[model samples]
Target: MSEEKPQRKIIHVDMDAFYASVEQLDNPELRGKPVAVGGSETRGVVSAASYEARKFGVRSALSGVLAKKYCPDLIFVRPRFDRYKEVSNKIRQIFHEFTDLVEPLSLDEAYLDVTQNKKGNPSASLIAKEIRERILAETGLTASAGISVNKFVAKIASDVNKPNGQKTIGPDEVESFLEQLPIKKFYGVGKVTTERMYQLGIFTGADLKAQSLEFLEKHFGKSGTYYYYAVRGIHNSEVKPERTTKSVAAEHTFNENLSSEIYMQEQLQAIAEQLAKRLKRYELAGKTVTLKIKYSDFTLQTRSKTLPYFISDKGLILETATELLYQERMKDSVRLLGISLSNLNNEERKTVVVQLRFEF
Candidate 1:
């Protein structure tokens, strides 16, 4: 007789409006008021909007001027990425207390594999609860968790009861749960894909499942296979720990755009310093340095150079970033300055030298 495969326990934790919530937690004046963390309302974009602002149709990636139009009383706060990174590190530390298989999707969300965990508890739901509670107790912030057998279901389940709540989908309930799910709710089904599905008479998971694999593949290609299996609760992706830093970067959008070379250099220096600190903290060095610039009119450009050797020094970063900054003439007044280190020297395995003794 064939043996049954082991079912893995996974959890997806997402902070509720993380950036905006952090702002509200730190500043009492911002609580209960429509708030956005981004640049000025004059000529920039919204990075995150609080729930209060969301009610007025303000959302991240929306232009600040339009966000203000949506919410007349919207208060905009500049983003403090350093503080956000600090909080993210705290959250990751908490995850490690339960399990080492923590995969961070961004600063605000992560997937955890707790099938074999330090706590020796079999209940993933209980672990998630404890993690959320600890995050609130330690950082004074709330997070929502979804416990399931796989990452796909867990991620979708996390959104079912958002804003400081959780949901669990057991192995037995997978099919029933997917059947009634709206097509729009399916992962990877964006607005355009959802509309296409609607045009094809596929409104729900049930509708999608009705099509044969050949039909789906014929119409949707590779993504169709994804939807075919995903709706059946057959996602098998694993959570991978961030064993190495991928890129070190820092960027700042100015309150007022500056045109002078001196002002640009000042901003680049600060960005380079921030990048240097991040690289040093991770014990990483890179051969490629990239400089990202955004003009007052919102046009963007990037210049990069690959050094002969990997360097993590602040002086090298500042010098390279400064050189990139002046490599081209100013197209317009600059509103944003950014520096990033790529081609990192990560994932290298250390070799151990051993001495052999021979007895005659």
Candidate 2:
């Protein structure tokens, strides 16, 4: 009798030691040597270290001093985020070749649904292999990929054979894989949760599966539901492409509270200048400018002004802020002053897209 296979196909691709690997790709001399990319001081930490460095007990986020202690001859390099971003865009373009449903976890990691892909490749494992080969060919860097029927198992599979390796966990293998998984390896389980799990004698996936849902909920509160479903290899959350800015605020606490209008105006101008810079950075223009004032007595008040058109200009922001500040009737010095711009633009259109997430 022929058995039917499940129809879901998911792939999780993670660049192995992404930042460090990118550094090695750019400079041929740094390959196969202990390389750490981040700061170069006692106060700094390693953001990423090469596999060679990892051999000497060095890792990302470790203090430079500790890393040096492990490998005295370790080389530390500064991170060039701009260059990293350029390479990331290149990698993303490569992903679009396989599937448009790519959900980037960060600059280095992403999930792709290749069940009905643009490439017309029916095998998810083959797509993952091709993607890895493409990434190495295009960027001269190595990446690890996991192929599975769902995102959860695929993410775990990617880490199983890391650093220039690929893994696949089919529907039939997920049960055994789950039984052997450490509870700490489960997504969303942090250091504190892992410690709590250990205290509760929940050391592995087997232990977690043995616990009652009510016990998980009682211990973890609202997030208990997540723990329960994770053991069963289920995650219903979709990858969200559009991220909304709830609010944009520019605030500066005064070194000293100001009673004089002249000083307050000076402060507002500086804040508006900062606000303008941020808006331009995000490629957004705001229609409403709100002023926040905290008086010496700790009482707070706010006033807002809406414009006919979206703007990110410094002069316009300062003018609007000054007018709103003037309207606030305050008899005391202000300890804090802030300017917020909201009612964001959508698709470069003048029409405002108010976040339904926001309540008036």
Candidate 3:
């Protein structure tokens, strides 16, 4: 008989309204008020929204104009990335205290593998609670956590009881917890994918599990296999300590739409300069340069060109972006301009796996 693999304990931790919460934590008067981090009422997009603003449908990626329309009293604060980074570093330090097996998804969230940990704690739920308490105490911030046997379930569980809360799906409960979950709640299933699943009559994990691997692959391609395994609580991806930077980009939203190629070229020049500076800071270069254009009506389009060799110079980026700008006729008045570099020079870091003895 084959030996059954031991269940792994994973935890996903996410800060509550990280950017907006940081704003509130810094400014005592902003507490309990609707706040948005980034963007202006006249132009730009909201990077994050406080829970109060969320009540009015204010959310990240929402246009500032619509955000203000949703909450007339919404207060817009410029994003202070440095401050947010400072807080993020503190939270990461706290995670390292428990386990070195941590994978940060963003500045506000991460996945931790504590099946074997520095604290020698057997109860992942208790460890999650303690880590949250430490975050609250150290950063004056509230965090939510999900504890489960794998990253997929842990990530989903983190959102179950959000904003200073946590939930754990133990090994014995993993299958049923996933079976009853809404299909949309699966981590990688976005709006388009959810709609596709809905059309295929896959509304819940149970429905997904009912489909054959061949059927799922036929519909979702490689992702079909993911769905087949995920619903069975079979995610094997580990919590990687080092996440790769897939791309680097810089973008600007104009206060007014630009109709002239000359004006657009000028904006791309500035964006290219910013992108180059960022790439230089990281000591990275890329062979692919992509131009992102957003029209006044919010229709998005992208143009990309691959070079013979990697380049991070502003002049080269600007030249390529300029070519792309004039490559196509104006679809509509351009409202946003961006430059991005991909196929980066950063080397892929390999992960080392370790065997652990599970106590739970």
Give the candidate number with the greatest lDDT: 3
Native-referenced Cα lDDT, model 1: 0.87
Candidate 2 local Cα displacement, residue 190, angstroms: 1.3
Candidate 2: pairs in clash: none
Checking candidate 3 for backbone clashes, the offending pairs are none
Off by over 4 Å in 2: 1-7, 241-360
lDDT of 1 by residue, 177-294 (tens): 9899999998789999999899999999999989988888888999888888888888877677754567889998888899998888988777888888888766799999999989
After superposition, candidate 3 runs with Cα above 4 Å error: 1-6, 251-263, 273-288, 292-316, 323-337, 343-345
State residue 256's C-alpha deviation in candidate 2, in Å.
21
Q: Report the lDDT of model 1 for residue 261.
A: 86
Lowest lDDT sum, 10 consecutive residues, model 2, at 351-360
| Number of backbone-clashing residue pairs for each candidate, in the order shown | 0, 0, 0
How does residue 44 of candidate 3 score in lDDT? 80
Clash number for candidate 1: 0
Model 1 clash pairs are none
TM-score computed on alpha carbons, candidate 1? 0.75
